[model samples]
Target: MTTPHPTHLRIHQLAGLKPGPKLLVTGAVHGNETAGVAGIERVLKQFDAGELTLLCGTLTMIPIVNPLAHRLQRREGERNLNRNLRPAPIPQDFEDRIANQLCPWLAHADVLLDLHSFNNPGPAFAMMGPRDNDSDLEPFRHEKAEAALAACVGTGRIVEGWLSTYALGLQRRAARQGDGSRQASLVQDPHYGVGTTEYMRSQGGYCITLECGQHVDPQGPEVAYKAILRTLTLLGMIAPGAVELADPNRPIEVLQLYEVIDREHADDQFAREWASFDEVSEGQLIGTRHDGKPVHAPSGGRIVFPNNKAQPGQEWFYLARPSDRKLKP
Candidate 1:
């Protein structure tokens, strides 16, 4: 048998004459979400046509992070490329090999714009990191800067508390096991919550995952394109006023994720067709558990990422409440 070769990522880099913060933009971390790829291509086309110029700093764009998955038009090749996105010592899986190359680039950047699209119907939003904290799992000191950058991304909604809440869910799951021992599985790994943005935060860079819209939504690509231009202008990589930014007076809604519900069985089902951002009342019937028990909402909040096809032991949905955190101007 012949030895297999590792896959490499296609990266586009442009450097300006002046020095500034290094900005990294990535697309299609989940291969099926091609909006980012389309948006990045549009920007590249402008560069080729001499319509856009980088005034300062370095701009690195990886139009497709998971080439194998993208080629197949699937969410992943071996596993979800977005999860556990850190350089691995062994580089075992297909994603691990990709991470080995991706992580160094992440660490070298001053900021990152990870573009993605959701599976459900909802307005585009930005997923940001928590406020500056010393947490060992996912620590960062760029909340204000992240928020400012996010505001210019044309999204009115910002959601935080992803890694921290996932860590909390893992703790609860371990507690339920009653053996005080955690399983040695990908989902159970303490750092399982570490994704592209989380890894960037750990490297001291401001980052945001902009969920453009539904995967197949035609407007998803436009949102991604506008976000890219806005980010370039906001970060001074391009001239100020080079592109239109989000309305300064637009009301920004911040949400903090608090709960992640895992599918306990293959037969678990949602009560109805619930969409992301659908408000759930306290004690409302959210779904039916595998054991024929009703799973009610623990509190009044909005449902996020409601996955009807999640496998057993996978995250089925998440709950979030409005956050009072103030954003910087």
Candidate 2:
């Protein structure tokens, strides 16, 4: 774990005269995903320039959640902050400390937008985790309403079942290593989404993680900016035409995540530089195992979050398929 710089986490807030939904937007939870932070800055500039106005409720933005990591141009400082979002009696690491501090405000918000960017180049999408009837998501107990609200951001792509993938990945890893702690944790709270958005959802708020695009994509920041504005309009915090909707008929492409592939040994390697959303056929050779055996696709699907730099015991990529479910604008 690297020592973080002694910088204070800052939250920018804007309040309107009329009361409405409280919206929380977080950027740079993973420091490498900088576009979100830039997007927040751009939006703030618009507000200061009188180009955008808050008609009701409040807007809170945390431009850089992991400042030290951001400064170092790395993904994280100590550990993945997004993974340690669950409340614990004592903070476990640097990210845990920040999560604990942010918990109260997260619980109070009516909605949350967690901004992020993927390592593998791809189109922008909005990710929503599973929330069962018994889950802690209070106002968003209905999945249909949640899907509609998420699609309102106009990202045009929606990802589902991340929690299941996370659990499946962990289960396979644990099974191979004969470990049980992660499995135990999953059993204890199956709904825990393992990210900032998931933490917000657990606190009875509607939270969406908008993956703008590849980390350094030029269009990433602008996409994030538009998403925030669209969200404000959707929440009725601003006039309908305050921000021109980019796509009048944005059709959300819903994907069901089913598998997460992990690099279990140093010798395991991907066969090619696969980008996110790259489609693969059944039995397609995707990589090579530690013993030089070929690794093939289990089914026909698209690969996402593929990493050429994956480490042993870490996720290398995920597999998903398009589903009939969609939210049409």
Candidate 3:
């Protein structure tokens, strides 16, 4: 096994023959979301002719960023590995230390693809900036950006909002609405933000996020692998049409990444088996704290990814707004 140092987190790289641009792909920033790791593993194993050509740029692949989280099969370091990217106190927690080293690499990329999986059964989708989200990929880059996102996602469901606002803002002049010509979904806040992908865009790079599917699902990792292959194909980093792909259009919904409920202690218990996208009744008891206190839903909505093996302080469950299925967005 190769040791991953801060300077070289890249597990593999197929530098292009013609140095045009750099396309970086990362996986397993979150330990439990093993889909990216598995996806990259398959890509590495399937070495064919012209698998990753430096046709236009260099390709770098980092399979695991948070080994600690992977070791425990949980999200890493008390703080989410995606956040805490700002210039912070030099000496801090494990994630911060890693961020201090990694954030720069993410920010410095020319084009980056950060792979992740969700707790819920999710359609493969692309997560981008707020219409107001600032990014280095802003201005003249909207068309290509949208096209890139569109090509990566089998579904049309794209994410925008606070993620673009907070982390995405770090890259550009400041994401203000009614500016760019591209009519992207102007989201104020979606669920997750300040993640590594957002941070990369902040540093003047083209970065996109891919949610492969439910993390624990056996096919989840394979789906992510397909995503990686497709994305590289779109970027012209590999042979065109290298693999057959899934073309599925999903309804677009702004995912407001809510707070995570963890189930570390044995005392934590769910009221019932919650399914992904299950409709919920307001004030219904979703689960109980380790102390046996009732945890209820605040409103009538859908339950997103509901994890049963969350670490004591990590996210165990999440809330989501289900599509009415009547109104088309």
Q: Pick the candidate with the highest TM-score.
A: 1
Q: Is candidate 1 or candidate 2 better by TM-score?
A: 1
TM-scores for all candidates? 0.94, 0.89, 0.68
Full candidate order by TM-score, most accurate first: 1, 2, 3
> Of the pair 1 and 3, which is ahead by lDDT?
1
Cα error of candidate 2 at position 127, Å: 1.0
TM-score of 1: 0.94
Candidate 1: the clashing residue pairs are none
- State the lDDT at 295 in candidate 2: 85
In candidate 2, which residue pairs clash? Answer: none
Report clashes for each candidate as comma-separated counts. 0, 0, 10
Best by lDDT: 1
lDDT of 3 by residue, 1-329 (tens): 73342333546877666766576778888878888898887887675443544466777778988766676677764456775455457645566566666766666568777888887565666665434243443322443563455456454454433342343333221233333421121121232345775566556676667777777778777777877777777767677776765453444554543334445466688888876657788899999887778899888766656877654433466665543222122
lDDT of 1 by residue, 17-126 (tens): 89998999999899899999999999999998989999989999999998878877878777877877888898778889999989999999999999999899989999
Off by over 4 Å in 2: 1-4, 135-142, 178-193
